[model samples]
Target: MRNEIALTLQKALRELYNIDWQIDTSIIQRTKKEFEGDFTLVVFPFVKQARQSPDMVAQSLGDYFQQNLHCRFNIVKGFLNLTFPCQVWINFLKNNYTNTSFGYFATGNSDVTLIEFSSPNTNKPLHLGHIRNNLLGDSVSRILAACGKKVIKVNLVNDRGIHICKSMLAWQKFGNGETPESTQMKGDHLVGKYYVEFDKHYKAEVAQLEAGGMDKTVAEKQAPLMLEAQEMLRKWENNDPEIRQLWNQMNEWVYQGFAQTYQQLGIAFDKVYYESQTYLLGKQLVEEGLQKGAFYRRDDQSVWADLREEGLDEKLLLRSDGTSVYMTQDLGTAQLRYDEFHPKEMIYVVGNEQNYHFDVLKLVIGKKLKKEYGPRIHHLSYGMVELPFGKMKSREGTVVDADDLMEEMIIEAQNKTSELGKTDFEDGKASQLFEMIGLGALKYFILKVDPKKNMLFDPEESIDFNGNTAPFIQYTHARIKSLLRKAADHQINYNHQSFNEIDLQKAELDLVKMLYEFPQIVKTAGEMKSPALIANYAFDLAKEFNRFYQETPIFKETNEQLRDLRLHISQFTALVIKNAMTLLGIHVPEKM
Candidate 1:
């Protein structure tokens, strides 16, 4: 659509200038309704080439569109307004509205891309931070897939480390083999509690031992829980049957808990890579890099990568003990994925804090291969999702658990439904609606912001139904559905029906224009890799449709033919919104 508009304008300009020089028409702008045009073609850039005043260039273009082109045109303050023909826009909306693939990109043009996100440590249930990561990754993949990209969604689980040992130690000392069912707690939350318990007891034990005036290093190393956790890690690494059994059992519970939460939030991944598997791969990569001179060996026998030439400091690739740090595992994962898919691009949908880490990874990969064969690595750095008070702190226990947050949103949705006098819904209908509304609210809230901008997530302000929210869009859909059902009962078909353009008022024309722009919105969102753009576009369309609904009468029109045509348009617009919202990973309930 952008290309079409640009081409048309360029042709008009060429005719106006009567020139043979190459002309570019990329300086078009969207104009305000009150400013007298739908799009403004800036003529200031042409002033030098055309050797004419900006105002004269604008007038000439406006005159060209009116006299030589098929569309109407007007000029305001050295800006040419190109108003597309009503029939052109009407045809665009009708064609797109009737087709199932109206707002999506052309098929067979998708690039193979890998998207990695939602990397959580095994020590705790997912918190608000992970929620942002999950949504961004899932939404990015969806957006790319919508744009006809062969997107591979992956997750790297951080399941091994001292953090894992903390939970293991706590469970060993205090669990007494209590299962999640026995404790009546969600598996991940149950495990997380033990992790917190371990910290408390371990700190106390260390303090008590130190008070006895023992050597600092000896006292710390001999701390009972610390030593036990270390021993457990060693046993686990050595494949000790008893420790492996316990490790697998606990991790199974955590996986089950994560599955339930993911299902509720509508997130999925094509592959799951655990640190237990990838960390060793990371260590192996360090050894390979050292042999290849991609990395250097320190005096302390640690492996290092000097990225100072890349404007980064030296980084520890492998510890003196030959263990992988966070970065080593990332480099290994990149190689593993490339070996698997050979993707044209790899997008790590991580947080802004890891920007520097990815920079190092790219540098190391470049050095190791001595060629730019690392596939296009992009660190999709998103900002923190904060609360009204401040950042969510896990150790402070003030973090919003994803499960708990979803539950709260569900309850709020249920209460809203009841307030709307929807208490008579079927047995499971309310539960179904709760999931849709809750998840929709959660996704829409997050995706509505620019992914790079730090956003505040106030629990109280997250799910308003009256504003530019998921529920507002959902309600618009529900209303259209009800109206469509009524239209069906009345035996209406507007496919062949026609209406005069004279009746197209401002609100009506605004709606038609908004509906016509859905494809462009989807295209822009895909190109920019920003789902928030579509979110904003969806809300804008819904708002305009609602206004049109309040002011324009579809059912009450005296002309049956015209009434039927308007009804068809309304139904089609509703379908477009429903489909667009789905691309953004939002669900619309029938009655919200």
Candidate 2:
């Protein structure tokens, strides 16, 4: 409808002033609530083109629309406010109220986007920081898919490195062959415990050497534990039989642990890449760069890329001993993805800390190596998630475990749900509802904030049943479901009814208007890669529906047309809420 109006205005300009204007260049937006119109057009940009004052241009355009387009307008200074007749809104609702896939665009074969996220290391279990990354990546993938993009979600596992060797060495020396079955602990947690143990003993050894009249730097290098871990990494790189066996065993444990956590969080990946496998590709690329004079070799047998001319320092590609660095592995992974999928865009959903790393990656590929797909690389750098106290350290074991935090959320959900006397749930249904509310709260709270900003996640605050929380929106959906069921029991059939002649109340009209914006909201969210847009849209829609429900009587309305219209409006609002929440990877329960 807005497009039609814009086109009409463009034709009017051509006819009135013999001017050629593009429809897209015209500015049209939804009017503010304080204004008395459905849409507003800024007339200032066209005032000079029309050779008249802003008010005069607005009046002329308003008159044109009122006469030809069936739109009434009010002039507010330089803004021309336009409102359509009641039948226009009524026709909109009648046409789209029952659409199951209202806001989602269907993807075609040509649209392909590959998103890499949740790149977890096998040395530790998933932590709070990992939670934020996984949620943001997963939600962004859903949003993009909703906007008609063919999305391929992938995870790059850092399975082989010095960090993995640290945990392996600690377990070999301190652990007496204790397995996850023997200890009854999660596999990732068991591995993480040894990683912390390695750190503690390494630090003690350094401190002891420092107390023995040795420099701190030299002591750190000479520490027995640190040297042993480095040797282990070298042996693993050489594919030593014993070392390879241990590495495989420990990595399997961590993978099992990671799978459990991913299942709980409702995250899955289409492809998984191991750094150990991809690092060789990077090494090959480095060798090629050296041959092409894009990289230099040092006297110590190390390889480096000189990016100083590009404002970045020289980056190490291969160590003097022929081991690959993180950058090398990333390059290999990027090349592998491009070869396999040839995606239109390759987005790395990494944290803001790696901003410089991705910059170097792109520069090396684009300028140094001269790869065509290098410019397609995008770093979706997001802010960190912090608690009220401060930051979390993984080595010190102070970081919150994703599994533990999810369990706590479920317990909190149970307590809050019981307090609200919503405990009429049947045997197994109560547990399911608790999981829904708990996970919903966690996901929504983290996603509600803009992805570019750091967020403080408060579990208790997020689980509340009021004030812009997921529970509020979920409960609103449940309330509408209950009302629809009641209508069904009372034999109120609204499916075949015609609401074209019914007069919509202010609240009803407001809701229809809000629903009208869902498609645009989805498009904007996908363009910006922000799930917070959908999250907050769901909140606003829910708030509007609650206001409408309070002011309007549905079941008791004596007029059948009015009651049917209200029921259809209620049903449509619920559909929009469900669809929007789904984009955030959140599930709203039919019964809260």
Candidate 3:
């Protein structure tokens, strides 16, 4: 509908006398309710080219519409108020209401996109940070798929590091083989607790060893627990039977726990990339760069990439001991991904703290590889999720555990539903509704904000029943479904197929306008890679739907034909809301 109007005005401008410029129809905005029309196209941009007053441009466009166009038009100052024929809107609603796909399809141009996110270290359970990363990555993959992009979602598990050893050493020294089942705890939290225990015990042990007439350096180097963990890592790296068995056992438990959380959150990946597997990837790349004269080797045999001219300092690609750093592993992953999918685009849905890291990556691609791929590499770096008290600190144990947070949201949703007297639903249905509501709340709360801007998350504020919230939209869907069921019970049919016979009211017009804009909203959100646009559009549709519901009656209307028309409009509105919500990775429950 928006495109139709824009093109209509574009043709009018082109055919107009003394108008030599391309018409800028980009300003076609929905006018306020107080105004006379549904959409207002401002013609002020063409004043310079038209060499006439804004009012003259507007009048000329209005005259063209009245004389040459099928749609009605009016000139309100410098804006063109255009209204479609009543049948145009009715036909649009009729088509959308009956269509299965809601008028969306893949663009047929398939480009593989590798999305990397949720790289959680094994030392701790998933936290709020992981939640944000997972939501963004998962939502992005879904959106890209909706737009015909073949997206491969991958998680680069940071399974090996000092962090992993902390939990392992703690378990070996103090756990006494106390398994997750033996301790009756979730595996990740169980592992995480021992990680905390290791820090306290290691600190006290270091102090005691130092007090026994040992220098700080000697005491630190000779710490028994630390040395034991290092030995464990070395043995595991060498594929020692017993150590490898223990590593597998622990990581399996952690994976089981992670699987539960991911399933609960509706997050899934096509492939998993483990750092332990990919850590050696960058070494050969660094060596290749050196041969190609793209990198310099230090006196101690460390490989360095010179990026100072690019406003970044020299970065060590490989350590003096021939160990790969973070950059090297990334380099290897990129090459490995190219070999696997040869993605036209690679997006890292990492945190904002790694901005400099990605910058160095782009620099390396330009100077070292000298490869210019059309599909751009994007770092979808979202801001850190801060708590009300301050930033989420994992070491201090102030972090919001993702599993616990999701559970709390479900509980909150159940309580709210119960308060609304929604207990009459069947047990299975109630449970499903709760899950939908809870997950929708979580996804909508996260995606509504600009991904790159820092935002405070108040759990109390996050799950709200009103004001651009998930439940509010869910309620709108429920209400529409309820109305449809009622209409069916009353045996009302809308097959008269004549829309011009009924009088068009304000509420009906508002609903029609909102429904007409869904395709435009989908296109805008997809092109910008911003789900917030869809979120906002969903809320706007809900608001307008609610207004129509309150002001107009469908089942109670005197004329069965008019009532059926309104019902079809309501049905189309519900269909659109459902479609938009799904794009944001949210579901609409029939009841809330």
Candidate 4:
């Protein structure tokens, strides 16, 4: 409707006033509630260009709209409010309510987009922050796919270097050959435990040295555990048999544990890259940088990039020992992804702490190294996920582990469902219901907030059957489904009835108005790269449906035509709720 209006207005403006201003659909907005139209267009912009007063411009556009379209319009001040007839909305529902592929526009020729997220280290388990990263990446991928982009979800596992060596050394000394099986723990958790042990013992060693009257900085460097971890990293880098074997075994265990968590969280990656395999590519890039003079070698033989002209200080790509830093590996990985996918865009779903790093990366790779794809690297930088007490620290083992948090979500779902007196489901399907509700709550709570904001996740608050949480939307969907089933059982068929035959109530028309906004909502959400738009859209739709359901009667209505309209709208609402939730990687149950 906005497109048709925009085109008509553009033609009318050129023909009437000889103006060539480009008008778009964005100018045609929803009419304010106090007005008496479905949509409004502020004509003040054209008042100056068209050489007319505000009232004159509104009147002229209103007349043109009435002639070119089926909408009726009225001008108040400078606002041209247009209201479409009943047949317009009736056609909208008839054409789309039954179309399962209504809003999704992805095709074979869509632009290729690669999103990298859920990059985890082998030394630790995924924490709450990781959950947010995974959810955002997955949701954005889904939204992009809906917008007709060929999306590829990718993961990079930080599986090597000093961090992993610390865990490996700790397990070697203190694990006493204990395995995930022997300890009855998840492999990632088992490995993470030893990582915490490494920190504890390393700290103790440092403190002992400090007590001997040594400076704290010197004590830290002289710590035996630190020295061992560093030596182990060097041996692993050199492909020593013993170090490599231990590295491979511990990494395998971590990978297995990661798989389980990803499955539970409904996350999947199209491709997975490991730092261990890609570090050599980083070294090659460093050598190339030196020859191209994009980077310089210091007296100590370390490779650095001078980026001061770009308003950033010098960056270290490689250490004096010729070892790669995070920037070096990232440079190679970015190039590697381009070589493999040739994606139109590469998005790194990382925290905001890396904002400067990505900035330097773009300048160094795009300008200095002159990689064409460097300018396409987007850092979807998000703020930290803060806890009520403070920030979580992995070394202190205070971070909320993903597995443990998921388990807690399920328990919360179960309790909330039971409290709401919604536990009448079959015993066989109860667990499935709980899992769906549990994960749905978790995903929605995190995804509903704008990805750039720092959000405090309160598990207890998310599972409430009331409010904007997933459970609320899920319940609304379930309620509408129940209404549809009842209509089905009673053999009340609305399939052959044309909704244009009825005098629709204001509430009924309002529901249809909300439903018509879904496709546009989806388009806008994709363009803005925010799932919060879709999340809020679904919540508002559910709230409106509840309002409409309360004020209107379906089977209880004596008028057959009105009853059919109610049932048709109910079915449509349920379908849309399910569709929107699915885009957020959430599932809505048929029964609450």
Give the number of the best model, judged by TM-score.
4
Ranking by lDDT: 2, 4, 3, 1
C-alpha TM-score for every candidate:
0.93, 0.97, 0.93, 0.97
Off by over 4 Å in 2: 299-301, 458-463
In Å, residue 134's CA in model 2 sits off its true spot by 0.6
CA-lDDT, candidates in order: 0.80, 0.90, 0.81, 0.88
lDDT of 3 by residue, 434-544 (tens): 888887888888888778888788755646767888878988999999998887787876755776666678888887887777776776666676778888889989999
The sequence of per-residue lDDT tens digits that candidate 1 reaches over residues 1-592 is 4456676667865676755434443365566667765667877767787888888888777776666556677776677788876666566555666777777776595578898999888788998889888988888888788778899999989888777878977897898988899988888998899898998898788888889987778877889988888888888888899888878888888888898888877889999999888787877777777788888998899888888887889998888987778888887888898889878889998888878888778878876545354548888999998888898877777798899888988888888888888777777877988878877888888889999989887777646766888888988998888888787788876666355453455776777777767777776787778889989988998998898889888888888765766776787778888878988788876665
Cα TM-score of candidate 2: 0.97
- Pairs that collide, model 2: none
**Per-residue accuracy of model 4 over 1-592 as CA lDDT, tens digit each:** 7788889989988988888977678787877667788889988888888888998988888888888897799989899999988878777877788877667775779789999999999898999999999999999999899999999999999998888999999999999999999999999999999999999999999999999999999999999999999999879877899989999999999999999999999999999998888976778877887899889999999889999998899999999988778998898999899999999999999999889999999998998899899889999988788876678888765687889888988988888778878768887788888888888888888889898999775534443546988989998998988898888899988775566677667778888888888888888988888889999999999999999999887789998877887888888888898889989999998888
- Cα error of candidate 2 at position 585, Å: 0.8
RMSD of each: 2.5, 1.7, 2.5, 1.5
lDDT of 2 at 70: 88
Looking at candidate 1, what is the lDDT of residue 90?
60
Expressed as tens digits, the lDDT of each residue in 61-121 for candidate 2 is: 8999999888899999999999999999988888898999999998877578999999999
Model 1: per-residue Cα lDDT at residue 432: 89
